[model samples]
Target: MEEEVNNELPLPDIEVNSDVPRGPFALLNRYGNKLKRLSSKGGENSSKSQLLSAMTIMNMAEKVLSQSIHEKRGDVSNLVEAFGSDYADYLKRVVWLLDASEKLTKRQYDEAEELLVLALSGSLEGHPIETVLTFYGKYLQEKIEVERGRIDLERKVEHVDIEQAVMDLKVGVVECEQKLPYSQISNFTGVQTILDSVAAAERIHFIDFGPKFGSYWILVMDALARQGVKQLKISAVFSATDSVEETGNLLTSFAESMNLPFVFKILHLDTWEFKKDHLQLEAGETVAVFMKFCLMPLSDQPNGIGALLRGIKDLNPLILIVIDVEADINALDFAHRFKEALLLTCALFDSLEACLGRGNHYRKIVEKVHFQEVICNGILSEDGGFKRCFKIDLWRKYFAEFGLVEMELSQPSMHQARLMVKGSPSWSCCTLKMNGKSMIIGWNGIPIQFVSAWKFHYPVSPAIDLFILH
Candidate 1:
């Protein structure tokens, strides 16, 4: 039997928006509602419709999780594997659609759609369904060829090798996370403030400092939806470059799928040039803005950071949420002599200069030699990597002058940061504990929180959030 051709909807142009909620409860409800509706009426067979379903399920399931409830802190330690179990089934469906699109006649197309609707609704599994779909697609393609009086078989491309394609798909998904993972962010100080401010804002203007596809905003969409404001719109400014596209797609799809009462516009402003978006903030428009895990890059290259801040000053967001990352020093200069600490802790580096390029981004760390050493030979210690403790005091001064009253948003101390450390990348595993109520950490024991140099991708702590929020 000949196979059929599958037609899926074209991907949409993606971008960012500012007024998204960072909470998960609301989203859970929304997903539950959608699942109910689909289970009741059966799933859709249209390529785009099925793809959307797959994405929604996958998006909701992105986190490494063991519990579904958020308040149960006891179950926090049982970490679900990075890629949970449901992923395999979802991947299979996606593969079936992609490989079997070339074998369907129109009649078979209709039948295949019905079969797909059924297949997606239940636990039935395997290549049989895929082969059937492939057969249908081939049948349609053959019929079309017959009408045109064409005879060509050798030129046909076979289905993608399932195992290899699945492997590649896993890599693609991981690569997507490599671009930015909420888990990598352990220090979450300003996230809650940003969420609260944005959720409360009557009108909001937002800026995504690095703006990788706006996943952080998706996390916050639920709050934005509940604001109940008759006139609510969020304007987001982002880097206008290819670096921002992939994440932008997820952000856009998420926003569209939720059908929130807000709109988004993604910009391509280069940090080097310090281009700012010409925003139109009206009176009574309450603006709450945040930059996700982008402080390091801006700090290392201050000229661009200065330009971005100058642009930000123009809009004057009511509350500015800055989520900073600790590693990726190429983005900035480390405080408290981190190189000395890295050299002391890591055997690979005989001296601070030698270790700067390893584990740490070699290029940027060595660009300037003003790092302070915190943990000596810590990287080589039986644990994953050395713990280089530092602070973000510089940002405090920069924003303080603007009349922003800062509050420590993190729970303060990460005592026995072992659980948290396990979640970090193998190359960058170290812990920081708070002594007293101070937000500062020591390099070999020096208080440096005032330096404003911590960094991360999302402000949400992965250990705590993975179960319910991811």
Candidate 2:
């Protein structure tokens, strides 16, 4: 991302995300400032770190969870005192953000109520905190007071039929096909590269984290079919043991109809875990892993995403395709979480409004089910261990920690995404954003979802090298 330093827009109080444009004069060593704020500093603090975190809510929001470290060390006073009086308000704002976040985490929206108001009016950072917060507050009120979605947020732990939830998600996804185009763009952005890399292999394999009716599987088959791959081996892994037989039948029919040597094996996970034993891989089969909106839900558990990723790393797949709805829905604060969810749902709702008009009752029904499963359940509701989704930067950090290197999502992929947006009806106003490494699907320029590809980075075995030398 380019640092378009516009020193002219003066906002003395606001701080911004590194990629977010800001009003304040560009500080000295602005590059360092960006790096410190974005990195996981792990209780380490410097003059630069203190200044940036103290001055900006985006950085400070991250550090809020670490207040215990300071408290345990009897340095809570240092938080307010260190920045000096001139910037104390900024630090105090950070405190308020932290407090509000805590209240939200405990499911106390009322206590964090003022924080949302502050988020609505305040613009102390580069991120669009105010813009998103404003929408979130309104959205939250509507969800609570009005019965728009089937998944009610007020009811804690309401029993929802698993089959009904699955069907609703399917309905929502079907409606989203022509309207949103996010999944298509994601599939278009990365699947071809994986297919191209594995096309000539005698046998091919797949381990989808959450197949959910085999959408990514369909994309893979299409790409390979175009590559004239006549035979292959395929596997899908899902934590939820739903519709395994039906999914197998669907893929088997596709492979047989295409005259390919393919087998679809389903692992109906007895436990809600990503166990290597469940993969059922055969020797010499090139494996490509698919994780699409599946890992985020598991993030609610401690070490959930990391452990599963480690399992994936152990497998040493030929390619890994990671896709998710791009939003900051995982802020540790209620107001911020709400903002992220609002931004994400706004794009979906807008796309539907533009394409699926109100007169179409079936489309509305589908949209409602989708809104509940994706928006209400996936993002807003505190039940079902729902947690917020992180942005691209955090995901990159997590991938790096797990020894995964980004596979350059091809230029043709970017062009493919761009063409999809351009080729849409002239009335549709969504845009595609490709920041070289990742692609974001946006509505009215606010990014709602992101997609990227990665491969495991294996360190060279020194023992093997020494043996070869001997």
Query: Among these predicted structures, which one has the highest TM-score?
Result: 2
Candidate 1 residue 106 Cα shift, in angstroms, is 77
lDDT of each: 0.35, 0.53
**Model 1 TM-score, all chains together:** 0.40
Top-lDDT structure, candidate number: 2
In model 1, which range of ten residues has the least summed lDDT?
Answer: 461-470
lDDT of 1: 0.35
Query: For candidate 2, lDDT tens digit of each residue in 254-333?
Result: 87777667777766662236677777777887888877776566656645666677778777888888888676665444
Q: Once model 2 is optimally superposed onto the true structure by TM-score, how far is the C-alpha of residue 56 displaced, in angstroms?
A: 25
Q: lDDT tens digits, residues 128-156, model 1?
A: 22322233334334434433446453344
Residue pair clashes in candidate 2: 14-124, 15-124, 15-125, 15-126, 16-125, 16-126, 231-261, 326-449, 329-388, 330-388
